[model samples]
Target: MVELPKRHKLEQSNRTREDEKLREFDEDIPDLRSLVIPWASMVIVAVIAAGIVLYNNHCDGEHSEDQLFFQSSDTMVEGSSYKESILERFLSAVTVEQHHVHKPVYEENHPSLFPLTTADRLGFSFVIIGLMVAAGGGIGGGGILVPIYILVMGFSPKHAIPLSNITVFGGAIANMILNVEKRHPLADRPLIDWDLILVMEPLTIAGALLGAFLNKLLPEVLLTIMLVILLSFTAYTSLKKAVKMYKAESRALREQGLKPDGTKESELTHINHQVEATDTNKAGDELLKDMDLQEGESPGTGDMESLAADKADELQKILDEERVTPMYNVSLLVGLFVFIISINMAKGGGAFPSPIGIKCGTYSFWMANGIMLGTIFLFCVYVRAYLVERFKAKERCGYKYVNGDIQWNSRATIVYPCICCLAGFFAGMFGVGGGIVKGPLMLAMEVHPAVASASSACMILFTSFTATTSFFVFGLLDPQYAPVCFGIGFIATYFGQIGLSILMKRSQRNSYIAFSIGGGVALSAVLMTIQSVLSLAEGEQHKSGGICGKDS
Candidate 1:
């Protein structure tokens, strides 16, 4: 190797350097397919497995929790009043002797709307209108439409839940379309956060299903207590929000250097420049502190830094204030879950409980619908009156009303009614009070809380009507029990209306509904667990006894 020429050796060294650089470059470049494929496959497999597990847990099996299948709990027997215990024992006996022997016929046959008799059709139509009217009345200081429907119609909570849900479904879709097409307010801006809504929906639906099941397993007294507690909480929350709004408004006025009442506009208008100068001075000081450059730092550098910092801070503040983070979309799901758990504890009846056993008749469905529709009509009328009176009141104050014209063609008019119809359809299929969703949608459309609540009532009633019609069409309606359910429901509904009216006058109405629903869901979940465990134990006892006591 020592015999090589000097020039050749130099060339060899240069070649070696080039080779090393090439090797390093090659090392930096990864194999695209080999690097990504395995990880992608793993992710896909994991997702598939998770989905299967969730389906098994929530959707599949003979008694899917989503389908509202549940057994009454053992704890339901505890703390029973003497009268309640006697009634429970009798019901249990009847359930064992009658219901257990003959699986409910209606449950097996999904109903269509074609076979509804003229009387049933008329009755249901009236009820739908009535529900709407009642809802309006409640929100406008009249009645709580939902409870009224349940109590008056004698329609089991399960049936009412779905019926109400369909209305919300329809109404939401309609509103979305109108917002996009007619109003154009939500257009050209990513105003509606789909990500939040998507995340929340499944949770809410799951909660609703669970609530429905729990309703089957629990007792009524516990449900009532939970409702009361929820009502109180809602009232408190509403008041808290109102206070917060007032405080925020006051703070804003003070920041603008205006009087609290904003009566002296001229005195405050000249302070804008002074306020700007003060803000600048403060921002400059902050900049100097951030740079580790003290008060003695070069005046030019300090000034520049302060200006930059001031701009950054201003931008940050603007961003924070302008961001539209929606609480309703996500919170709705949580509330729904709460409701599901609580209502189940009420342990009412089912959507298609044994037709031969206790058919909640067509009239029951009709009355619920009627209440809602009637409420809507009432709301429109009330709103018109309120607007007129408000304008007159303003005139009396020496200020002509600037805007008395209600925008009828605005997006809300179309969106709200549409949401009602869509929500109504699905709700009927599921047998629920789709009002939960409808209430929020109504609020979003800038409807007054009262009107929104009333609209929800109206929508729910129609949904129930559609559902009842379907049930009857499918030969699920039992005529004999119809009168009895309607009579009982009528009283209950009326009472609910009166109670809700009293609450609304105090501005504590909506909260009551929210709290009642949330509490009801939670209570139902507990009751269901208790009932299931007891039923299992009972089965075990019977197995050990070998001789059964003729099944209750």
Candidate 2:
């Protein structure tokens, strides 16, 4: 108003614009702290109540000595005809053995709907908290779940593994519900990558089956040690990624002349139009530079407008191509599910009698596995071909890619799924969810945090539900407590998803998602190691039988 200098007026205008942008960003960030506490408390209380009932049953001696922990090595050696050498004894003592059979400790071992007890309340609280956090990261939290179920809830490994699967299935359902309609942050397509799901899930399931077989062969001590090491590494990598993202966001804020905290000095209205215009102009300038026109020539308004229109049309086409149709994907998945279930039901598993009476270690049982493997192999080949073709088409069309859009080239289609198979193997071997490994793997592949979370959740939905169904068939899931655990998982996950969404929007930091993943993995490593140590200290011994031998 007082005849300011041109430079001074320009500076003032720039500052005002920065403040307006910051305010707009901050408005979208809601205070979700209030919503978090109550939901978390409810989860804690529910799990604790369940824990009490389990603790009571354990105290009542419902669990046999073998069921309470692994069979003692000394007891096994006592029955052996030949005396073992020192090395053999050491190996036997240190080894962890898992059998295919699952005999329930009691006919009615599931917890009552609302049991009251004081035992393991703190452990129960941790389990609920871990589930909520893992849900935010699009994981099943099984790494934490199985360990807690065994160590604190007094569940045998046989029961705990299946229960963990059920809980993860419930959480996956919640995540899928939230993600199905959500759009990708940078594209018009759904956030859940159906293409990724189709390509990875079959191989993942196959790997899980293989891993479960290997689990019966491997020592528990070795598996436990491997899990701790792998999870610890994953946690470290995820946290490192989070830290890098945080620093990058801070740098961006500084470059924009805005405070990292998003505080603004002045209130403003109708800044959206200005911001859009500014962004469009910047984009146009970038486009013109990329064109590399004659040194003396500048883009005329008509030329610029034409280029912008062409760009818009190209973008529209890319989006249309990328938009997923669930029909084909779902069909393939359903078919795989049916085939796998059929095989498992026919061959029998653990305590669930085979419908066709196929005994374990028989030629029929191996044949069933062979058929399943062949089916998965054919399915993977088909999906891989489809993706490679799609990727080629995209390349030919000059597609403009966004962050986290996987270039499903032939090599990628092959390599990534193989990595996923390994991830799934670890999942089955350690009795955790594949998401615990795959979530970090996606991040390592440079997928956007939102896309990684959504896609991983979708994958978990498939894998966990499949495992849950198998457990249900095998009579491993506790009817009374299964529904309760599932409900808690659903509610906790719903709230966790909502809270993380708000926080990410408010802080404009995708790094929070990575942090959640890292924290969950790290917690799992500690919990599992503790459980293993406890078992070892108690002189727990596993029954290591031959692959084709009778179930111990």
Best by TM-score: 2
Give the Cα error of residue 185 in candidate 2, in Å: 0.7
TM-score of each: 0.31, 0.73
Candidate 2 — which residues are off by over 4 angstroms?
1-113, 120-124, 264-318, 548-551
Give one digit per residue, the lDDT tens place, for model 2 in 1-552. Answer: 322343253345445544543453344223211222332343344335334433443355432322232333343444567644545433332222235564533354645546634434655676678888887789779888888888777877777878788888888999999998897766556888888888778887887777675455455566566667677877877778778888897786676666775443131112324543454344334433333333454444554456445654654565565576567778888888888877877777545557786755545766888899899999999999988887655433234455566777666677678767777766766667888878877777667888888888988887788778878866777776688778877888888889988877655667888888878888888888898888877867353232332335
RMSD of each: 22.9, 14.4
Predicted structure 1: lDDT? 0.35
- Model 1 residue runs over 4 Å out of place are 1-143, 150-174, 177-190, 250-350, 353-552
The collision pairs in model 2 are 96-220
Provide the overall lDDT of each model, using Cα atoms, as 2-decimal numbers: 0.35, 0.67
TM-score for predicted model 1 compared with the true structure: 0.31
Which tens-of-lDDT digit does each residue in 218-282 have in candidate 1? 23333333333333332343334334444664676677666555544444434534543454344
Name the TM-score of candidate 2: 0.73
Task: Name the candidate that leads on lDDT.
Answer: 2
